[model samples]
Target: MQKYSERKNSAIDKTANPESGNVQPKPRRRRTAVNRGLDENGNGKRKPRRQARRSRSGGFKNTFLLTGIEILGLSVAAVCAVIMLLGYSAGRFSGTSFFGHLLPFTAGVLVLIVAAALFLLGWWKLRQWLRRYSEFLTPALSLSLALLTPWLVTHDQFTLAYGNFRTLVGGKEEAGRMTISHQVYAAYRRHDAAQLQKMVNRAQEYRQAIEDAARSFAVDAHLLHGIAATESSFIPRDSHDGGRGLFQITRVPETVIAQARKRLNVEKISLDDPRHNAFVAAATFKHYLAEMKDDLFLGLLAYNIGPANGGLRFIMQQYGATDFTTIQPYLQTLPRDYPIRVLAYSLAFRLWQQEGRLLAYEEGNNAIRIQRIGIPGLRAGL
Candidate 1:
């Protein structure tokens, strides 16, 4: 019995001593509050509140940003569409009388508004369907449509429409401009092609000098060419009218001469030199153009009249003339048709530059095409 008890005690000591060769099972671990997702009170813990809030805020911001971009893009497209439609309608319904003009314009506006609304609704539906393909697809299409409007207005077929619309809204100033433009057309029609061709050929000799002066003074090269053509017919000589050189420059302002001298970097000016003559002429024209508030007709007239008898500005003030039209009656003693002749010649040079030859103003479709090309130093596209 003593041997049995001693053997049992030895076994117990070996099990408790891990260094002994006997294997022992590990103790089972009790669950902690953190692993079980409970607080010290045994309640379920909430997810990190700040992280959840941040995720919701981020989603809301993305939604707002996309909404703003979509609205801006659609507004741009709508404005472009409205301008095109209004311009087209105005051109089609233009008239002088109340019934002839007002009724048709009003009817057209109503019709166009209804049509535009229907079109927008259809487009919105289409956008909804396209959104399934790509979130950007609708916005891209809208922006593309907006960009295309400018090109469309400038297109040959649409230019006339746009011009007519401008005229309709442009009032008396536009009427005067149109009148002067037609006068130019008429003058051009009267030109003998062979003689005009000779003038164009002669212009080639001074073309480089004239172009350089024009560039220096920010004047149109063709316009300078026109002045030369009218003044000396490209002969570059003194005239009986006390005018000298290719431009027939006379009575230029002291400031104009100084500006020309500065541009040429010359201490003295000689009218005999074509380059000097061209530069002086360009500077003089630019000076007059500024004085006349950039009215192409009045500017040309002022240049032609020069500072003689207190210049074109003084003459206008004396006669209470506000525009080229009002000044016409007072210009009988002056070269009233000077600007027209200059522009007619300028148009010829422009034609030569564009078409490689002068177009007959009466030829088939040439009239419309030439008008579209427009006069140099003025707006093009009719």
Candidate 2:
């Protein structure tokens, strides 16, 4: 019986053994919470750690970008606002006396600060409201404000304000410029309207020639017209002073004549021909203008003086004169007021071109308006 029982157990062991030819299959592994990517208690699956960090970092970058854009927009708007408001305030508070100007200016600045703070608060609320509709609203509003500021400055009140601001900040050079400019204004005021009107009418025929020459030499046409008006009154004649044609063609440098010849593409220059006369005049003026370092007043004076007496440079050096102001006393024999008269005439021409009539300086607010229009060849403020 024991041997039979042992034989049955041996038969079962052979069936379970891998070395035996008849083999049984192995059992499958049981599933668990850890293998299924869940906690031991069978909770929700955990996300990848790297993926979670990436999501938070992306959110932070987006928030930082938005904050930077907002700050940039606000700063631009603030800068533009400050420039315009400060310009206006400085204009209003300008006074000759130190304390008189300082006290009022300080008070105005304080008021502006308060006003700006209130404006910023209101803008912040508006920005918040606008952000709900569109994320780009803040930048758009800032761009619009920048564009609007330039247009606002073009208005008469703002124009005056800008001029006052320049005056306040300007140094001795500016003071000298203002003094000379006022002289031109006085000369313009003295001109008879009828005579000036006749001169403008006479210039119509020569306008094409003058403008062509001006373009060829990169000169201001209105300024050339002033030179013509002062020289021949647009009459174009041979003078007793050895001057010929419309510009009172005096002695011009050989280089100027050569440049004029090159520009006209002609073998010979004829002062009788209005075109040739204008080209020569333009070249001559350009030469002197460069020699004088583009100082308009000095250039005009040099043009009027021509190369006579070793030119204006030599004359200035002889008297130890440095600028237009210092050279005036030494010009007893020369036409010291030539530049002023020319500029005055140029201003008249500009006024006629813009307003269709010459503005009388003594007329109500006409002086300011004309000044705002500015002299030709000179840059206008604002």
Q: Candidate 2: lDDT of 328?
A: 91
Provide C-alpha RMSD values for all models, in order: 9.6, 8.3
| Candidate 2's TM-score | 0.77
Across residues 1-382, which tens digit of lDDT does each residue of candidate 2 receive? 9999999898889888879886766678787898888998999687999999999999898767766776776676666566666678777776666678878888888988899889889988998999899867776776666567666656677667666566666767766787888888899999999999999999999999999999999999999999999999999999999999999998998899999999999999999999999999999999999999999999999999998889999999999998999999988799999998999999998899989998889889887788888888767543
The lDDT for every candidate, in the order shown, is: 0.85, 0.87
Top of the candidates by lDDT: 2
User: Model 2 segments beyond 4 Å from truth?
Assistant: 1-84, 106-125
Give the alpha carbon lDDT tens digit for every residue of 1-382 in model 1: 9999999999888888988989567677888896677888879875788989999999898767765666677787676566666777787777767788879889888988898889889988998998899877776776676677667655765666656666777877676677778888899889999999999999999999999999999989989988888888999878888999899987888898899899999999998899999999999999999999998889999988888889999999999999888899988788889988999999999999999999998988888788888887767554
User: Model 1 clash tally?
Assistant: 0
- TM-score per model over all chains: 0.78, 0.77
- Which regions of candidate 1 fall more than 4 Å away from where they truly are? 1-84, 143-151, 380-382
Q: How many backbone clashes does candidate 2 have?
A: 0
